[model samples]
Target: MTITFRRMTPDDASAVTAFLTANRFPFHVNPAPCESSANKRVAEGHFWSKESQGYWVQHGGKDIGLAVLEDLEDDNPVFDLRLAESHRGRGLGVDVVRALCRLAFTELPQIVRFEGQTREDNIAMRKTFLRAGFVKEAHYRQAWPTADGTRLASVAYAILRSDWENNTVTPLEFDDLLLDA
Candidate 1:
């Protein structure tokens, strides 16, 4: 399935919360912060750094997932993305992330690099990030705190504008880098 991201609205709070509640993330369990909480945190406020813009993914006109991103204290972009169970594993993850990165780089003037973090055991996510040109940069032992207070190892990945630009600029006729079914 093909997916795309659209701007998020305060009205999307319920849907975002519902998606998070029904989804099972390996190292996370906090319910989507209360609607009012997310609304307030994601909403514009002087204390909250900067508000995030969320995009609900759609495939063939049906909502299938969400991707949320924002700039934080160090002028770095942080993001979270999820694909519905039925939408995972057919290569849609890379497509969604690319779209998000493109939008982020285009709209955010100060952003030169974009970053994301995921549990080390999340192989699929790591692969998707790599294939989309993000290089795994750091590994933190037991960084992901679980519901039981157990911590899971976490890894962070990043891609800079120059990295993506240089890689894509090279014109290679051979298809070694291409994915095949």
Candidate 2:
């Protein structure tokens, strides 16, 4: 299965709405998004904006998911990746992360690092981040709000441009600084 990323435009609003409403993203802030809400989000430039850009995650020429790269004007850009229900456990996330890194680092020269955050319970995504060479940088407690009025720890992972270029994983020295209580 050949994975590819296609840039999304305003004309693709309907497609984006359909994709969002058709799939259930349990890990996302809004899991089962309503059609009207999806339409509203699309209309409000949630996908395509000055600070954000969207892309279609295609496999074998078919649209399988969506990847929205946010904070484009910033040095560290983050992405939100969602795959179709049928394509979730098929090991497509690593490829999606790679594609996002390629798109950000290769296309945007100003980006110093590429980051992504997922709920603490999202084990698959955490593993995907590790596999994609992203080091765990932060874990904000109760940062991810779910649809069920509950919150989960938001685990952030990032990869520097130097690491990406050298094809290496720069391990974080979390234990370097020790403070006396």
Candidate 3:
């Protein structure tokens, strides 16, 4: 599968609003977003700003999903990816992730790492991250709030620029420190 990223602008508000409201994002904090709220977010520059930039994930000239890269001014940038309900679970996660990595590292040279977080129960995304050469770096217990009023563990993953360039996974030394009682 070939994936492409098209930078989104303010003029794409209607398209973005439709995309957000048309699909049900089961894993996101707001699974079912209303059209008005979606439009509000776009109007507030949440998608396109100095610190954040959104992209339309395209495959075969069709928009399949949305990817928003945040904290662009920082060395470690993070992203939010949402695939349309119709496009999910057909082996597209890995390709989208790899494409995002390529775009970030190649287009934005100053970023040292590209990061993403997902609910611990989101096994598909976790696997996709691992397969895409991202290392699991952090796990915040009960940090991801769901629309149903429950919180789940937020698992964070990241890929270093050097690691991505070398096609390697750098394992985290989680046991490096021990607390003395």
- Which candidate number maximizes lDDT? 3
In model 3, the clashing pairs are none
TM-score list, all predictions: 0.76, 0.96, 0.97
Ten-residue stretch with the least lDDT total in model 2: 91-100
Query: Model 1: how far is 149 from its true place, Å?
Result: 2.5
Encode model 3's per-residue lDDT on 100-153: one tens digit a residue: 999999989999999999999999999999999999999999999999899999
RMSD of each: 8.2, 1.0, 0.9
Q: TM-score: which candidate is best?
A: 3
Distance from true position, residue 95, model 2, in Å?
1.3
Lowest lDDT 10-mer window, candidate 1?
A: 41-50
lDDT of 2 by residue, 63-135 (tens): 8899999998899999999999998898888988888898889889999999999999999999999999999
Residues 1-181, candidate 1, lDDT per residue (tens digit)?
5556677776766666666556655544342345555445444531223456677888788888777785544457888776777777777888888877787777776777889998887898999888888877788998888767778888898888776657652232344586777
1 or 3, which is superior by TM-score? Answer: 3
